[model samples]
Target: MTKVDFYLLTSHQPQIRERFACKLTEKAYRLGHRVHIQVEDQSQAQKMDDLLWTFRQGSFVPHALMDTEGAAETPVLIGYEGEPGAGMELLINLCREVPQFFSHFPRVAEIIDQDENNRHAGRQRYRDYRDQGCSLETHQLSI
Candidate 1:
């Protein structure tokens, strides 16, 4: 069984989301877990990359622009492209659509409830995934 975590955040700021995702990824990495992130936009993806570089100066996190070509085999797969399949353990999803890529992973963490529709959708997703026997943990952020 895989551990899944969900967070309801009050802040709509891009920095807050980026920071939270990075922090979570760092924690996961420290615990010997692989981290996978998918940002909504190119700008957000760049911000995440920048944050990663800043956190570990000169260190590189594997990044590939999502498109029809698909993502190469790697630990951290960013962008909206590529098929979500085996080998993915931990996932940090920022996209509103909730890509089908994360379906196989039992452990999926995300920040939801940024808006009205999202609030409802997020809650529904939580319930649906939980009903499927996925271990779910939700945290509300002060942001």
Candidate 2:
């Protein structure tokens, strides 16, 4: 069964999700996990790709866009649609809705903001995962 972790943020700041995602992906990479970040669209994926490079001072994460060459060999991959390449261990989902392919991965991370829209969507995703009988957990993030 897939393990879904919902990270609920206390701050409602815009774009916080992406920033946190960068940090999360970076940590996962450092731990030697292949991470694939799924966003709403290509533009969001581009934003994530850029943020991963400069989200913090002197941060370096080896990553590539999902559609790019040799993405399967990269430690992290960002994509807007479709399934990720082979050997993907963790998935960081930034989309409003749960991806249809969520259960395929061993672990799925959902980042949620405090705003009404995000909270509502997060609840829906939680319910969806619960219905599927997957192992679900929620954490409150101070940031």
Candidate 3:
């Protein structure tokens, strides 16, 4: 069964969730887990790709956009549209709804910041995952 983790952030800052996503991806990469970050569109994917490189000073997380070249060779992928490639162990979903290919991964991370829209969508995603029989967990985060 796939495991779903919801990280509820106390801070409502718009960028906090994206920053946290970068941190999570970096940790997963260091731990040898291939990660696929699911976004809503090409713009979002580009945003994540740029943020991952500049999220933290001196921090480096090797990644590539799924539609771009070198993505197959990269452990971390930023995906907007289309199917998530094979061999990815974790899915960090930035999309409002769960991606159709979510079940293919062993683990999924849903980041929810304190924004009303995000919280509402996150709740829906939580319920959707639970109803699907995924192993669900929620964590209240201070950030």
Candidate 4:
């Protein structure tokens, strides 16, 4: 069974995003699950690298999204930079979209802003996953 979680970011601080990513990585690691993250650009990917190193060592995992070009198979698909993919145990959304990507992953989570506009988008994604028979949880993080 897959689980879904959504977190609302209180601020747009870079540290906050990194912190959440760390938490996400730790969660995945503790569960003994492999992770594949997708980002919009090299910069965001770099940011994730910094945070992920605390949990993972050695050469960074291949840029699966870039290398796979949405063709490869994965247990988790993250939509940060471009089109989001499903078929993952967990999907983490780092942006403020409606999270169409959640439909693909069995477990989906989004880090969204506290503002009304972004808040609804993240919550809607959570509900969509839940409606699809996924366990969903939401968190609010301070900046």
Q: Rate the local accuracy (lDDT) of all candidates.
A: 0.69, 0.90, 0.94, 0.56
Give TM-scores for every candidate, taking all chains together and pairing residue i with residue i.
0.70, 0.96, 0.98, 0.57
Least accurate stretch of 10 residues (summed lDDT) in model 3?
77-86
Instruction: Write the residue-wise lDDT of candidate 3 on 23-130 in tens digits.
Output: 999999999999999999989988998999999999989999997887898999998889977899999999999999999999999999988999999999999999
Rank ordering of all candidates by lDDT, starting from the highest: 3, 2, 1, 4
Question: Per-residue lDDT for 134 in model 1?
Answer: 72
Each candidate: RMSD to true structure?
3.7, 0.9, 0.7, 4.9
* Model 3 segments more than 4 A misplaced: none
Encode model 1's per-residue lDDT on 10-119: one tens digit a residue.
88775566677777776776676666787777787777777876655555555444442545555565665565556767888877655565666767887774777767
Candidate 2 C-alpha lDDT tens digits along 12-67 = 67789888998988899999999999999989888988899899999999999998
Which candidate, 1 or 2, has the higher TM-score?
2
Model 3, clash count? 0
Worst 10 residues of 2 by lDDT: 8-17
Model 1, runs deviating above 4 Å: 10-14, 55-74, 113-118
Clashing pairs in 2: none
User: Top TM-score: which candidate number?
Assistant: 3
Model 1 scores a TM of 0.70
Pairs in clash, predicted candidate 1: 66-81
Candidates ranked by TM-score: 3, 2, 1, 4
